[model samples]
Target: MRAFVFPGQGSQAVGMGVAIADASAAAREVFQEVDEALGQNLSRLMADGPADELTLTQNAQPAIMANAIATLRMLEKDGGVRLAAKADYVAGHSLGEYTALCAAGTFDLPTTARLLRLRGQAMQAAVPVGEGAMAALLGVDRDRAETIAGAAVDSILAERGPPLVCTVANDNDPGQVVISGHRAAIERAVALAKEMGAKRALLLPVSAPFHCPLMIDAATAMEAALLDTDLSAPLVPLFCNVDAVAIADPGAIRVALVAQVTGIVRWRESVLAMQAAGVTQVVEFGGKVLAPMVKRTAPDLAAISIVSPAEVEAFAKTL
Candidate 1:
């Protein structure tokens, strides 16, 4: 069986999806749809980047989703590869979850685009700039990373007052984990990780503390928006980031989407679960980020990432 995965934030860059859109009319239509839905020239921002403007959370969230969906369109229209026939399961990272759901027919492209826009705005507003941060710990397993994070939070709580929170945000792979929360606690975790023999621990260039208790306000915002949005059962089960399990129910999917704002992305465990479920190959759509993580998590499983039109055609040939 094959599982199709979509990349989350941090994988986006200037000029993303341009190649596919140039090569296929279907891809262009996808971009046009997203541009109309958001009521702005997002496609221009993605193709011709001022870098900083494209990197804003509000733009990047839906821009990444548009790129992924456009790539999927390329595969379908040009390559004759359909998800219902070729994929057994679908999963995505962070904001990419919206892309996966859109790909699986859970929501229409316009709805997904609007939802991500709101999600990005809500998450950005959840925490003010400079107050929260995220850090990645390299060469550390999940257990050690958790230990370091806990110690950092405890130390901060002893010295600082309440509302200072730090927690593991992502169990990305066997060798990498990301922590997020208050800026001071995140900085403290970085220093503590270095002292505890971690190879490297550095802060990410993100604007908000994602997947931490600090995002409770964002979660609440999403809850209200999702309640009004329409969601259907996906064509394939989704290995949710928050639970690391396959979910099919629309109501359950809604809850997971809301809770994922402050929940750890159990990517490592989700890959392991897919492997246990007999997924022989993992195909990553949109960006190349998750392919490497799948390789690290399950080396035996064939993993591939498709982004450009040439890559899409090449993958189609295999199908």
Candidate 2:
């Protein structure tokens, strides 16, 4: 069986949708629709980035989803590939979970884009600038990363200061994990990582500390927004990032979306679970970042990302 996957925030880059959008009207329509929904020239920001603006949480979230959906549109309209017929399941990393739901027909493109815009805004507003941070620990598993996070927070508490948030954000793969929380705690975690057997730890360039308790406000915002949004069951099951399990119910997807705001993105476990469920091939749309991670997590699965127009055509031919 084959699983269709979408990439997360870090996969975005300047000029991400240019090739595919230029290649197919379907792709262009997806971009146009998203621009209309968000009331911003997001397509222009994506195609000709001032670099920093496109990287903003609000812009990056919808832009990433737009690029992925546009790429999928190209595959469908020009390549004669339909997701429901070709894909056995769908999954994505972090914000890409909404992309998965979009692909599976749970939410329309406009709703998906607007939801992402609000999600980004909410998450950014959840913490003050420079007060929270995220760090990536290389060559360490989730357990080691968690222990380091605990120690980082404990050390801070030992100083008689009030408790600060420090927790694992993403269990990305076997050798790479991300930690998030207070800036000081994250810095402390990085300082302790090497001594704790991690090869290296470096802070990410994100504006907010995501997937930690510090994002509780963001989670509350999403819960409110999701409650009012129209949702339908997806065409296929989704391997959720927070739970690392396949679920198809719309209500469950809603709860997961809210919970994922401050929950560890168990990407490694999700990939393994997809493999265990008999997914032998994984097709990643929009960006190439997640393909390598998939391979790293599930060596037995064949994974490929279709980003460029040529890659899209090649992938469709294989279908």
Candidate 3:
């Protein structure tokens, strides 16, 4: 069995999907539709970067979705591949969930693009700049990472510091977990990580701390937005980020999507679940990031990343 996965945020680059778009009209149409939906030429920003602007949450969210969907369309049109025919399941990291759903035909391209634009803006607006932060802890399991984060927050309260929050935002793998919350608490966690036996910890370059309680406002916004949007059942079950389980029901998908805003991304568990379900092959669309994580998390699976026409052609042959 095969599972198709989409990458989340940090996988985006200055010139993503250009070659594929240049080579396939199906890919270009995805980009063009996204631009029309968002009322901005995001493809231009993606191809010709003023890197800073392209990196903003609003831009990065839909831009990443566009790039991933374009790659999928390229694979389908140019390589004569079909996701529903070739893959047994679909899953994605954080924002990539929307992309996975879009690829599955649950949400049309335009609706997905607009929803992501709103999602990014809402998340960015949830917390004040510099007051929140995220950090990646290396060489620690999710359980230990959460304990360390709690220790950091406890230490702050012990000193009569303002009560702040610190929690593991993403359980990415056995070796890497990301924590997010108040800037002070997150910084404290990084400082205390090494002494607590974690190999290292460092702050991420993200503009907002995501997948934590600080994002409750974003979750609320998404709840409202999703209430008004049309969501069909996915062509395949999605192993969602928060639950780490496969869900085909639209209601469950909606709840998971909202809960994911303030819940830990159980990526390692999700991959394991897919493996347990007999997924022997994992194909990552548009970005190379997730394939390595899949390899590291589940070495028994054959993981492939297809971001160009040639890779698409080669992968299509296997199907």
Candidate 4:
């Protein structure tokens, strides 16, 4: 079986989909649609970037999704590959979950783009700048990271009035863990993680501390937006980031979507579950970032990263 996966925030770069966009009119149409949806020339920013502006949360969210979807469109129109016929399941990491759902026919492209824009904005607004921060604890498993975060929480509580919230934001893989919370708490956790034998603890450049209880306000914002939006059952099952399971029910998906605002993104477990479910091949759309993660987590699975027109044509040959 085959699983199609979408990449998240860190995968985006300047001039992301320019090759595909220039090569195929169908790909250009995808960019055009996203431009119309957000009422901005996101395509221009994506193609020619000052790099700083494109990296902003609001712009990066939809820009990454547009690139992924545009690449998929190229595969379909130019390479004669159809997702409905070729892919058995689809999954994505973090914000990429929305991109996966869009590819699976759950939410339309415009709705997905707008929702992500709102999501990015809401998340950024949840905490004041510098008040919250996220750090990556490298070379440590989730359990160890959790323990470190707990210790940080204890220290913060002893020093301050209440227990300062700190938690594992993402269990990216066996050796890659991300922790999120207040700036002081996260720094405390980083120091503790290094003492606990973590190889490295580095701060992330993200605008918000995502996937932690500190994002409750962002969750509330997402709840309002999601309730008002139209969501249909995806054509393919989505390996949700929260549960690490394939969810197809629209209502259940909605519930998970809301919970994901502050829930741990179980990306490692999700990929393992896909492997257990007989997914021997994994195709990553638009960017190559997820392909390396899959390689580390599931070395036996055949992983392909489709970005340029040539890669799309090559992928079509297998189908």
Better of 1 and 2 by TM-score: 2
lDDT of 2 by residue, 1-319 (tens): 9999999888778888998888999999999999999999999999999889999999999999999999999999898888999999999999999999999999999999999999999999999999999999999999999899999989999997799999999999999999999999999999999999999999999999999999999999999999999899999999999899999999999999999999999999999999999999999999887889999998889999889999998888889
Model 2 residue runs over 4 Å out of place are: none
Candidate 3 worst ten-residue window by lDDT: 74-83
> What is the Cα root-mean-square deviation between model 1 and the actual structure?
0.9
Model 2, residue 45: distance off in Å is: 0.5
Comparison by lDDT, 1 against 4, better one: 1
Off by over 4 Å in 3: none
Error of 2 at 132 (Å): 0.2
Worst lDDT run of 10 residues, candidate 2, spans 7-16
Local lDDT at 54 for model 1: 91
Across 247-304, the per-residue lDDT of candidate 4 in tens digits comes to 9998988888889989999999999999999999999998897888788889998988
What lDDT tens digits, residue by residue, belong to model 3 across residues 191-283? 999999899999999999999999999999999999998889999999999989999999999999999999999999999999999999999
List lDDT for all candidates, in order: 0.93, 0.94, 0.94, 0.91
Better of 2 and 4 by lDDT: 2
Q: Write the per-residue lDDT of candidate 1 for residues 29-57, one digit (tens) a residue.
A: 99999999999999999999988989899
